[model samples]
Target: MKLPINESGLAASQLIYGCMGLGGGWNRDPIQSEHITQAHEVVELALENGINMFDHADIYAFGKAETVFGQVLKEKPTLRENMILQSKLGIRFPDEEKGLPARYDFSKSYILDSVDGILSRLNIDYLDVLLLHRPDVLMDSREVAEAFHQLKSSGKVRYFGVSNMSAGQIRLLQNNCNEKLIVNQLEMSLDKIGWLETGVHVNQVAARDNVLPEGTLEYCQLENIQLQAWGSLAKGIYTGRDLENAGENVKNTALLVQRFAEEKQVSQEAIVLAWLMKHPAAIQPVIGTTNLARIQGCVEALKVTLSRDEWYTLYVSSRGVSLP
Candidate 1:
């Protein structure tokens, strides 16, 4: 069964694959046109593996990402019916376009203009999901909602959501929004335990990795919003030598991943997916790996389960201490 997406109730996969780093068009010092071909291969792989949701943002590679994805749709017109295409608006990259500082714009005219740019570039009649890339502090939610309402009423966009917003901010938007706020794109991971705001002893055990946010899971759960986890790889902080620096339980959990992967005949990365799946809250991982084999490994994680003891072992390791 397709999962319920917002109040409009579109069916979507629980795991939404992110097409950011995989696209090769984002932030490349010298972006090659040939890289777009590689991006299509990723789309092919996603379709082959049953990943129906594709995430995009207008500011990505300065609209080239949307163009690349549009090419896929145009080349294979039939694929559009089966896939749920999503894109973001409101992030203006002035540095990329005008060689000036970048800024966020949420004016009604700017929102409509961005939507047109998204539609023209994607070559789609409408978007399955349209999100505000980030919150604009001066955003007039009523004016923004007017555009959303018009878009929804016109069948140009089916769903509305926000990215990287606080619970209070979402409520503020929802208060003005006639349509429901569907998802909150967030940065979440095993190493980043801030989602649940799990009170861990950082100074006593290990220094906190500033990469992950704190208390997002609990807040999202309370607000009835979905969390999209980004950069979910087992890299950084404990890259190699610091694997020991990461703390003892962390080591045990890693050993556990090796053991489980061996037992299940899957890659260690699959164990990471399994661990994320164990969370009670809806954690739709936005995986960015372009490698097809690695992508397959992530899918394998969905099928595998981490035992209760093992889940805690990793959790304890993440905290660098036994659960008190």
Candidate 2:
């Protein structure tokens, strides 16, 4: 399925290969040959399986994720043309030496500089989409608009979007920027059911406790903004994560996932992802597994189709409660 990334005839894959696990561990570790080999294997495998959209962030692996990915592009530049390369910026990790706390930045200069850094590390000229990693509480919409204008005018980025933002926050940024925000990525998965709960819990006590901003899902659907789901795999919770210390609801959900996988003859990863994709919003799930077998398992989701009963069964099991 082609995702409506923009009106410029650019479309992304139904699944996005998240590169957070690339370039070794998150530290000042050097990019070793093993890391490079693993990257090549992952990229080659993902491309072979029809995943043409890759997601990245500057903060992933202390910037080494993009760095190693750059090696893949450098070795086989043609691969760059076949895929939709996307990366995000704006999150600044804490630096004790600089006397700085971890914070988000959306200042004009920071945006421009971050884009340059992202492009440089990825060894790319322009990004298919550039997302502000998270909303900066101190963001000035006008200032961000101006920065976007410069990036667009100079051909540094083709499109713009935001991540981890609420509907109200998106509206505020949309009001100031000329660019139409095309994507709003958030944590959505069977494990993170707040997005679904917000809709189902209306006029009920559960509504007050839902973490997803009300109307966020509907607003994205109404605006034609592509909703991408990060943490969509829920860190392998239901699929195969150890449930020894998990709650009753989680253990039950995991068992149900296995049952479905067995009945459908697909990987548990596929069932987990298919459940998320069943939503009408057409959410693009970002899968970050570095394991080759797990990556192959994730792509199996495209083959399985869960009916309404199956979908709700997983949902109710995960929530451990009847719908209000």
TM-score against native, each model: 0.85, 0.98
Decoy 1 TM-score against native: 0.85
Clashing pairs in 2: none
Candidate 1 Cα errors over 4 Å, as ranges = 27-33, 96-100, 198-216, 234-253
**For model 1, where is the 10-residue window of minimal lDDT?**
198-207
Candidate 2 residue 35 Cα shift, in angstroms, is 0.6
What are the per-residue Cα lDDT tens digits for candidate 1 across 93-202?
65766677777888889988898898887889999888888879899989988989988999988888888877777878889998877888876667776654333433
Reference-based lDDT, residue 315, model 1: 69
Q: Which candidate is the best by lDDT?
A: 2
83-157, model 2: which lDDT tens digit per residue?
A: 998899999999999999999999999999999999999999999899989889999999999999899999999
Supply every candidate's count of residue pairs whose N, Cα or C atoms clash at under 3 angstroms.
6, 0
Candidate 1 residue 284 C-alpha distance from true site, Å: 0.8
Task: Estimate candidate 2's alpha-carbon lDDT, on a 0 to 1 scale.
Answer: 0.92
